[model samples]
Target: MPVSEKTADRLAQHITGGFAHPVFDAQAIFRAVMDAMARPGTVQPVKLLAQPPQPLSPVAAAIALTLCDHDTPLWLDPALRQTQAVASWLGFHTGAPLAGTPADAHFALVGDPAALIALENFAQGTQEYPDRSTTLILQVVSLSSGENLLLEGPGIERTALTAPSPLPRHFVEQWKQNRARFPRGVDLILAAPEGIACLPRTTRIRLSEG
Candidate 1:
């Protein structure tokens, strides 16, 4: 269903209206997300009102609310395709376009990382405007282990938590290739039901090669 003006107005009211805490508190969440993205391999927290639909956890919705807008083109994975609630909420709140392919998307919501198509399938930016590439919102298993991987570069004060997931071995390699394109590679936000983390293209990830 299309987002009616009435729904948009209500959502705007809810967001702009007063909160128990300072209004900037919500704005602060946006800053936190930006900071996290600027430096990948790091975790950040944000408050959420209600749980978002499948594939898109509450944290993802919070991120979407903070960053997406009519200007952002969103690509939803199969898990989120039929989720009218999210589609309606996004349409009502941000008026984001539901894109048909990764290459055409500004941001993508992926539920099944294993099922996601090749990374090359998405925009890799260009020589003049590498920042034009896409950003991915990936729903992962967890962010607790504190062991089992290696993350380095850009954001690291000096290497942070051991990556919590057994990311596909090929992803790191593909990212290396993507980075050669410089500024053209995709940025990423890994989210779980409990928390969220960043993996901007600038971050260099090395899986434990054993």
Candidate 2:
């Protein structure tokens, strides 16, 4: 059984919808993810959608399917951690192992952004191997309805503003510290119904004065 067919078979077993066409769906999601990551702070549409269990948004689910694999350890937040169905669905589809702690995850999915674990708690990688850091996918209320954030960095020629709601408390403060880590910090992917946006470590963020 090929991975795509095998995935379809498993999708039939679960109530949640995995990609109906795994290959094409994953490719579209991958390209969307790459675009978002490359742009940093820009909202990008995820062309593919997946109906993951409660607390796991479609965009986030599509991301997990496209990016996670057997080699990437996944961490779920308390809200998602307690949801057994979420674990089973992601485990079966992505073949990613559950990480024992936030620090251990290569990719951490945060279903509840309001009470997210401290950014400092996750693996920050080392100056020698920055890619070891965790990449967080967070579900938020809206992509443009929260606190206005001004971002400037490699991706934006001048500056960009975003306002994803229900972010963890002290996010700007925490982000300043995270930014100070330079090449060793974790990157963030914010998901909402409208789509997804990113905050690569190379990007600088602050509460927009505007």
Candidate 3:
């Protein structure tokens, strides 16, 4: 259906600024995201090139604008999906299709970490095509150094410690199950006002010792 002029104007009003230099900005953000994913639990700052809607953080907005496109199927959490302005702005800016279920989403945008659905609910690509698994972009309260969890994985030469902002109940237990999926699990990008952190499927996580 064709959007009315009034609706278009409203969507446009909330459409935040994208990369000043699309190529360069996207490359920079992509690199940052890649680096964070490579080194799990490390916090990295993503420059806010765009001003997204109310519930979307600068970091989360940057990720969506950088990674999402017509080919990607995005799923918004209830909080974000409830806002028509956010949906319209995303449609106008990214042209990414909205998925009806988590399993269908190539990317899932979650505004409230505590309210996020189970990791198992999303697509966990087949062993033959693990690259097709879903990637979650979660907006959290903060990302700072506090050393609440220990991380060990391919990227870290030794164990690394990190403290992500508060997460949903039973997150660690859920993570263990997600990790058990091996080559077929979802990856995560946790975005905060300060920066973003990654949790690739391969990373081994455990609560820190006293």
In the predicted model 1, the residue pairs found to clash are none
Tens-digit per-residue lDDT, 64-121, candidate 2:
9989999999999998989777898899899999999999999999988899979999
Candidate 1 structure lDDT: 0.69
Go through the candidates in order and give each one's C-alpha lDDT.
0.69, 0.88, 0.84
Worst 10 residues of 1 by lDDT: 13-22
Taking all chains together, each candidate's TM-score versus the true structure is: 0.79, 0.92, 0.92
Candidate 1, residues 49-141, lDDT tens digits: the string is 434544456666666766677998998877777766667666655678988788988888776675777778887888899877888887777
User: Which scores better on TM-score, 1 or 3?
Assistant: 3
Residue 185 shift from truth in candidate 3, angstroms: 0.6
lDDT by residue for model 3 (8-120), tens: 87766666556678788888888889999998877788777777767777788888888999999999999899887777777778899999899999999998878888999
Question: How close is each model in CA RMSD to the real structure?
Answer: 5.1, 4.7, 2.8
Model 1 stretches astray by more than 4 angstroms: 1-26, 145-147, 166-169
